[model samples]
Target: MEALLILGGAVVFLCAWVWLAVTSRRLPVGLFVVALALPMLTLLLRRKGYSRPARLLLLTGILISAAGVALLYREQPEQFDQLISGSWVTQPSDSALSGTLMQQPFVPNDVRWQGKHLIFAEKAGERIRRSLVVKFDRAEALLQGTAIDLLPGDTGPWPELVLQWYTGALEQPGLRRLDGGYSMSLALAAQGPGQTEMVVHLHLPSEFGTRLTGVVVIDGQPQWLGKSAAVPEPRPAPEPAPAPEPSRTWQEVSILALLDEPQMYVGQAVRLTTTSGKEFAGTLTAVTDDKRVVLALPQGANQVDFQFHPVDIQRLQARPRQ
Candidate 1:
């Protein structure tokens, strides 16, 4: 009975050790070896008449394993909160944000643009603009319920830029915050000879005015980078020209006359205008009694046969050889 109790305790200790190792993503080699040897050690101690030591060893193993598992479980929530996974967008509104965050002070680096390495100007004075897209599982609900106040700011160059999390693994990049839906981050950076980088973070406030989630970090370069300090005002666009009225020649052309005399127009240059506003110019190749008109349209080095129904043609005019 004592041996069975010892074996059972060893089994429980082993299971707890495995769980802690897997949860923490690190295998404590010494603890694992001690766990595996506990049963053997207890058996040997009992056979040598050290029954008290056997009990003490079993109890020690159980307590240590339990403590490790408890510690890991206590930290599980914090580990979950620290995980950052989602689609992020960055500046001039076309770039995506990507990077890695190292723990033990949580320094973020390897900032990339759309998964590629970021390239900033080597010299100073380049004005850089950036943007980002953030996704949320409760995005619709959050937007609908909350009074989203996204005020843009950054650092490093202009000191007014900030940046954000998710689950089920966001596969594609997110769309830019449109209109008043969600606001995107915008910041201006003046490049220098040293490493020119910026980090953006996002914060959400709960309805009770408390902070929702932890900081979400987004990193990337600018989509539009210019050295000019003053942005030029965009000129007014020129007014578009009015479309000309469609030709009235189609009303005068008779389809029945052309069908009745297909051979007369065959091999002649013809222009066909469809009611749908499509025009085709080609040499009339053949006309079928079934009302199908074939035209040999000149391509670069060859001719392509274009077949259309006479019913579809709004105008079919034959032109003389030029």
Candidate 2:
């Protein structure tokens, strides 16, 4: 009975291991092999009459197999859920299945490439410069582009890349076919005088019709390239500097002290408080020779001057124009 139980457990574990190894794209090969070997070791222990250790080994194998399956499901929960529900399986000969796949493509939710804009970026020091602007047409199965070599600090397009077919055809005006997501070469014109013509090679691979992955080679040096938004976002203009704070210091002086050199305070503003506790503020329009002060106050759209004599004024404070 013990042997039968051990054999059944081993068989179940093997079936699960095989299913996982086949279904999971991210299953570690070494770990899969180790997990498979554990069950076999358990079987060997059973044959050697180490019953208790064999049971523990069997249990450990079962746990490892369950953990691996759980990890695979967690990696892509929706995909596993569909697989468990048997919704992913479709008969290859069914014409209706093809239409269904096209109408509802199986794009992973985490994939940001599908239906999203793509551009090429080149890292220049701390700044990421836009190098190429291209869009993938999945239905057409081609990459269309307008490529340019932008200088470090230029707002306008710099020396552009002149693309030509491998057959030496001249580049067509406007957006053109750059690559078919396989292999292509771009013949770039010499950016400056006394320089030779340059060719840029690109190796872009289309994976699952969602991402554009590749390497760009310039002058025999290969660099990694990926899809990014090409247009640089408009940076907000820096906020205007706050106005300087005004001086809080004020000098209390007699009305005559201001009238002595009235030219200095002619266009200045004044805040006056009378002995009767009345207050007025306006532009110091004029100071009469009669020791009477004239203040121009705004009434509606016109300026009306108010005259104050030396007796009516109690406290006078003067400040220059801001």
Candidate 2 similarity to native, TM-score: 0.23
Error of 1 at 291 (Å): 80
Candidate 1 segments whose C-alpha is farther than 4 A from its true place: 1-45, 49-111, 115-194, 199-201, 205-223, 227-322
101-212: candidate 2 lDDT, tens digit per residue = 1122221111111232233332222222112333433322112222212112223322222121111113222222333323223322333443323232232233312221
Query: Model 1: number of clashes?
Result: 17
lDDT of each residue in 1-322, candidate 1, tens digit only:
3234445556765654444334323335554344344444433333333334434554566766555444433433222222221112212222233322111112222233332122211111121122222333223222221112232121111111122211112232222222221212223333454322332322222211111111122343333433233424433323225235443222233678778887766777677765434456667888776577788876668877755655456677765433
Query: CA lDDT of 29 in candidate 2?
Result: 64
* TM-score versus the correct structure, for each prediction: 0.25, 0.23
